[model samples]
Target: MDENESRISALTLGGAQERPMNEKLYMLTLSFSIEGFIRQVLTQKNWEKAYNKHDNSLRLTIKLDIKNNGRIIESIKLIRKAIFFWTRNPKIDHRIWIMIVKDDTPFYPLEEEEARQLLFDFNRDIEIKPEALKKGKNNIAVFVELSWGKHEFIEKNTLKKESNIQQIEKD
Candidate 1:
């Protein structure tokens, strides 16, 4: 080994591919060496930062316009009943449940906290039966009741302010 050369600990790569009819696939790839990965991991304190970021980047986009007093939308239909679920948080209050509706059919309600966590947490996995999916736009609705207190909605300015009381004393 040359005096200037260092040992290689790891290697990483990222790529994507796309193709059209009778056309060659388009591809892009990027590789990272151990030093760079180690630098990022040490600075961020997260070893899986790169993997997590890439995995969570893909998404399905949908937009819904809500009408006043519209409680339910009945345009989507599901052909299957079985589904799988997971959420960002590993543990949540399982007693409360939330409803997930597809057209007139409703899948079994997921735990209240599980639904909330899944909606916000991108790292988790959720799978619905393939037969339940439609070719294009599909209408689905979620009905949930989340009770919040004053503390839950604290303003950012309030969080930045220093506490007025410097110290506490017990009488």
Candidate 2:
């Protein structure tokens, strides 16, 4: 093939196709459920978003503002289950791991040992089988054991959970 043809082929080659509407909804639901944990750790209602890449895989990073929370430990406790659920290999659809970035920058600064401990607690909360976590070169990752399909599904349980958590806190 010529250069022009080769360029066209590369552009067309690999990309994830759109998932079904229901599946998209499911993926969003799953994402929302996982993101909800940030609320407990953050003083703000919204957290920043970013995509992660390592080992040739795309992971999502929810750069949470975990600074203001008086105690990051308790917030970690509350969302332990939800974090594991969303980060699991496959649940209501979607296959990806998650990392909650907690830093003590202006106050405490980043510490891998502390971060590892928090990750350990969160990993234990997951109901399914979880693999031993290893700290990657730049960061840490808690691996989940399961093969997730490309179907991308997110269930509708998020709204109810959001409401429940909201009601409990009493803004």
Candidate 3:
């Protein structure tokens, strides 16, 4: 028999009904337009003062530690940059930030409020998986995707499972 047929036969033999395993998985993605986002922030009067105080340089560096019950399990650092702009003259520098989490890194979910605080005053979008939203459930998997624009930040969540059985079935 061919490989596909053989595998099907093996699974069907003996009347042993096999059920798909539900392995938990999570992922996150963040996107934003660097120039558009920076310009949006700089337009703010308070932010303008802050920018000028820093020698007209806006330092963009964010560090987030994913925690469970106040214990950190994972840490993520967002895109970092130093942008210089003049208030009198409006000119946008061409620098964009794009990042994707590596597969090997551990996944952690932050509360909506916590995440919001981390990205406060910045234009960004965040996405997370459904399974990661369980209340009072720790050790859950989550994925986050972020995209940013001018005066628009989006956060979304999605769920995907990765399991050994699924891998074997595909093979």
Candidate 4:
């Protein structure tokens, strides 16, 4: 076999398809925040840096950006500690919901059904809007309502900001 043929075989040996040099992988960045009843859960150090008590409800904002690809979602998981913080108070009954909005119309194939499926696969109980799915560059916003109590607070801390990027490649 020629050098070029051997190189091609090597690339495909692991079930990896050869992509164009110009083609880049997609990246999704999710920025999350926690607010509301934080004092009950956060440590003294984290509380002072990441605690915000001025908002009416416990809010978690997840800003995600997909790059070089057009996949809706991979997975979703809730932080039990954060949920516990908001639910500890017996006097407060919070109804939490998630709102997902597309900042830019996503590329084709990333439609409402895909988005719905992503959410459903993650958690069947959570509620999501069908209209939230739209075609755009690759920007999506996810708002997670942690709690809805009378108290108000806003927390901004480096530790509270959770971000993740997932790259999906088709064989």
- Report each candidate's C-alpha RMSD, comma-separated, in the order given: 23.7, 23.7, 18.7, 18.2
User: What TM-score, over all chains together, does every model reach?
Assistant: 0.18, 0.15, 0.27, 0.22
In model 1, where do residues sit more than 4 Å from their true spots?
1-15, 19-96, 101-106, 121-171
Candidate 4 local lDDT, 65-100, one digit each (tens): 222233444334342212112223343233221122
Tens digits of per-residue lDDT, candidate 3, 1-171, equal 322110001111011122334643333322222222233333334334544465332333344443333444555556433333342322323222211122223212122232222332332222223343445444322122223322222112221221111101110
Best by lDDT: 3
lDDT of 2 by residue, 1-171 (tens): 322110101001111122354322111011122222222322111111211212221122222211111211111222221122123333313333333333321112133233223432221221111122112211111112111111112211211111101000101
Rank all candidate structures by their lDDT, best first, as comma-separated numbers.
Answer: 3, 4, 1, 2
lDDT (CA) per prediction: 0.24, 0.20, 0.29, 0.27
Please give the distance, in angstroms, between residue 168's alpha carbon in candidate 2 and its true position after superposition: 27
Which consecutive 10 residues in model 4 have the weakest lDDT in total?
4-13
Error of 4 at 139 (Å): 3.9
Candidate 2 vs candidate 4, lDDT winner: 4
Instruction: Give the per-residue Cα lDDT of candidate 4 at 56.
Output: 20
Model 3 scores a C-alpha lDDT of: 0.29
Over 4 Å off, model 3: 1-23, 27-41, 44-56, 80-82, 85-136, 139-171
Worst 10 residues of 2 by lDDT: 162-171
Question: Given candidate 1, what's the lDDT at residue 146?
Answer: 15
Positional deviation of 1 in candidate 1, in angstroms?
Answer: 52
Q: For model 4, state the Cα shift of residue 113 in Å.
A: 41
